[model samples]
Target chain A: MTHKKNTKAIKLVTMIMLTSVAQAQVTINQKLTASIYSDNKNGVEGDDGYKLIEERLEIRGNGQNIEAYARIDLTKFIDAPSSDYRDDERLERLLTSYHLGDWRIDIGDIHLEMGRGIALSLKPIESAGVDTALRGGQMAYQSKKIEFNIFGGEANPANLDTLSQKHVVDTPDRIIGIRGQIQANKALPTIGIFGIYLKPDDQKLNELLNAEKEDQNITTGITIQAREILNTFDIYIEGDYQKRRLIDQEETGKAIYSTIDLTIKETIILIEGIYLNGFEQRGSPHTATDTRVSYNRPPTLERIDQEVLETRDILGGRIRLERPIISEDYVGHINGMYRIQSPDSEEEITQIHGYAGLEIYLPDKLAFSGGYRDERYSGGALKGEKLKSMIHGEGDLTVGLEGYELHAQSTNELRRRPSDGDSGGEKRYARGSTLLGLERGGRMGLTLEYGYDTEKEGVRQHFFAGIAHWKFLEGQKLRLAAGTQRGGVKCIAGICREYPAFAGARFEWLGHF
Target chain B: MKYTLLAALLLSLSAPQSRADERPLAPEIKGKSTQDELINVADYKGKTTIILFWATWCAPCKKAIPEFIKIQEEIGEDKIQIIAINMDDAQTRSRVKSTIKRNKWKMPIILDTDGTIAKKINSTNSAPYTVVIDKQGKIAYSEEGYTSDNAEKWAERLKKLSTEP
Candidate 1:
């Protein structure tokens, strides 16, 4: 009887193994970038010879129910501006996830978002090497009508902020959050509720902020959304409340974000509003190096060209309209916004902004698009003496030339401010860039670019660069760039990443296997 | 002159004729369309699929998407499936549906809210990246940025993959 039972179990195990083997598949994706540079930055981090080599590789593996990702970096400097021989190699990111029926569990680095990034948002934006991801664990469940996630982790901001070429050592905060959603019937459609609790390490807080205001914050929010209403309109609204417990005091805050998009007779209209009263979520309040890292990024409700504005005290909104011009190929739009910012402070300011753009698609594989924007800020009343103003324009043109294609791009922006010395002619500052390139299929590409800025500190005002791109194999490309590049503030969404200027000859090879 | 000739010859090895035979599997994509419909990449595997990563602020993407729409209309949807994944960040995400409607985009749209899809596929966190996966769930062609003149080339690649066994 024992032998018979064992034989039956063995047969069942063999059959299951065979089935698993039949459905098994594995795939790996990788990205490797190599940079060789020799720079002449005048007085900057210039190299005498081209001996500084940096390599970064990101690899991801996927199976039927599992995924793993990692990023590794290597830097080698033999002899540079000074006599230094250093070789560094380390792993930057490691993430893994497993998928089970109706459940997914993730460990290592991860990104999370809730209700348009009001409650939580941690992601990457590539400009000059400023990308932030959380090092934590998350468990999510999804079914037909319900979804929820339980996430907790520590913050791991990017180590290097390329703009300053300085390492960022941030206080790692322990964050825990829960978000759940359900799809109710037709009228109420979707409802979501979320709560996030953040605790900053006391040691790091004391070291950075002088041992006085160790903040522990708790945030709870709710979002309600309705889509496809009458087949023409969609609306969404979110409300947030914050309870801050500081070492010396306790403070409470509230915020609201909302948007409505309406489509009627081939034209689309949108209205958005945000009211933030001291409810901003910061991952690290103050780093050792005097930088602030944020976890939640609420909508700015304005153009991104503006510098990162203070969301601690503000009430603003915008309205936009877009329609087709001659045909669907030609599109046009106009946008305007008004806001009173920094109301709690003595020097409050009111801002008004306007923007217009058009897209034109012509015959013979030709397309042209352009946009112009004007923004004004007043210290007292609407249409009063302007505290500052900005005007910007950009254009893009693409045309087919025989067997090759030509791409031309240009951008210019001018900023003016009230003259402080009385002899200043509006104190004008401007920046502009242009590029022209030609490409043929996947074989070859050649490009030339020029950029100039009037207010670039610690770097040259003019930038001239030439590049050649050659593509081959499955997913590989080699590019060579030789010239000077001026670095400045690159703002995305509501955050800005400053990059360092460069004047060098660099070769880069990018590929995946 | 000799070194230049040698370098040029070696670089030319990556031409179409010497392309690699192995195809990397495409990353998983699951999101909700602007119409609030669930869009999953796994469900559509029997035909060639073209996935376009785009955003509103990216002017080139605006140009590339329309040309792709014309291609799909001419090629017939029965043979190919094209899904445009919007990579708009949280601030600009609300404008996607309206942008599509105003532009008269005749394609299925998906939202990458936290940029999870773009990251999984190594999109460099930028816009106008295009990817093509054949019926076997393998990446057949990929391009980082788009140019207007490459429309015909993209059409040729898609049509060829659609007919492959």
Candidate 2:
């Protein structure tokens, strides 16, 4: 029944599009891409291969004061036999937006944001990890000083595969959200207030499991920015509150988080703190009692209580400094962050990280740069007085001449970790990595890299990667890259996710007219 | 000797295509509609397309939507298409639609839900991707992350794209 309804809706939209084509100043745009990769090892060593192809077309125009836009991505990917890898093939991202003076309405899969995005989308990387896109809609109105917005949507379950199906799940069937923000006048500095609300779909929850009610989560906050502070310093502060309610369980919880950031000249600093306190919600089982276990375990009924892993208080701060040492010829930078996590009854965990680097340019068309980083992790339960420390240093040198260029970089790291059962015994971890590249004018570029990691336990892994790109025509290009690496956590952001050591080669082709 | 130095300096400054220029424009899409024919950058001649590349798995993209919508409204529909492309896979389509219906976006949406368009646009497997295409179909601006400045620059590009051709 739902499929039928959707088909009808699609047909209705297509018909409308066909009819509007004649009246509007229509335009069409298209893009295509293909990528292929192969590996020699299976799940553990990277024995896998895939070929992916994608094409897209879009149309847009305005008629009678109403403006419209639409686009589509057609994609296909070859599947590997490994169960750990999943193939993606389908059409994605379909929606439209309309405008009328001060008010605008967006429908379909939509993205949203509120305030400085501290309690929301706060991350150095684009993904942010804290929030994901949603299939939803949003409406907003803006005046000279104040803007109002309200949005509601549902989470996409494509990544739900990351969760084990055996758990008592309350996958949100639908989510509705609303928010509003007011900006201060230019003369008064930029102060703002914002709020958000999220409610889950009850019907879908019931269908997925025997939950009595759908879970609902709410978050709201206010932000303030000061411009006239100290003439050169900018200050921003935000505080937020959140609540989550689940069905069939007496557990419920709420959280509060706050952030402050200050910037002065070439240096900027940020401080953030969050406290989550409440009961264990239904369908989630990780309680506060479970000690130091890998958080990536698949979901299961036995882990339902894990969701209520007790009240947690986290505090972190980051500092970044950038300055030129010799006018535009040389530069220096230092970035550092520290975090402390404390659970209601568990031991506190502390992590300290810092990186410092400098860049220099020579009079002979050559540039050089290098950096050093140190990370220390400690605290928690079973790991009594244990510490994991890592230090990394790297330098890059590039030389350029008429129509030709050469670049090279070398990186080395030393890691140490306390033995599992022995308190004072430490293990040695060392790694060295390097990259070299050569390019000629606009015709072609080639790069090669090698990495070696070793531990005191005689466990060692070496990796190599080489890539080449060739520009064949005015708007055409071809690329080939191959790489193999062993035994290292593939980290996106500071969140470390492990990918089995693997060797792979990739090929790509792109063109435009 | 002076000429040799000058030539060498020019060679040092000249590099391959700027990583910024290779960014792809987000797809533009419209559902079957009655009054306004939903259009993307491909539908206009005098305007620029500000493709806002996003994904269901992206957090900053979600946070930047309100700003994008505002920029779109401020730019006015006659000038640009603020295409918010979602890089979700096909299995996630139903949820993508639900999100669209729920958020009430006022711009035309292009589904890269399967990630096809994202790859075509040169995104590094992440979201909150953005790019601007001028009336001449040339990509004028591109970025991988979201910020208030990103929106402001996009609005600026709209003015430039509309005026160039």
Measured against the native two-chain assembly using Cα atoms, what DockQ does each of the candidate structures obtain, in the order listed?
A: 0.27, 0.04
Q: How much is the lDDT of residue B30 in candidate 2?
A: 26
Against the hidden reference, what TM-scores do the models get?
0.84, 0.62
Q: Which one wins on DockQ?
A: 1
Error (Å) of candidate 2 at residue A257 is: 6.4
Put down candidate 2 lDDT per residue, A28-124, tens digits, no spaces: 3334555454553433333346555555444343343333334444445566434433444322333445656657775544554454333333111
Range of the 10 consecutive residues with the lowest summed lDDT in candidate 2 chain A: A298-307
Model 1 pairs whose backbones collide: A163-A498, A163-A499, A163-A500
lDDT of 1 by residue, A47-146 (tens): 3344556665555555566666655556555553442234555545656667776688877667878788876787676553546666677898865467
Least lDDT summed over 10 consecutive residues: which range in candidate 1 chain B? B6-15
Off by over 4 Å in 1: A1-52, A77-87, A202-214, A285-289, A363-386, A419-425, A456-459, B1-22
Clashes of each: 3, 69
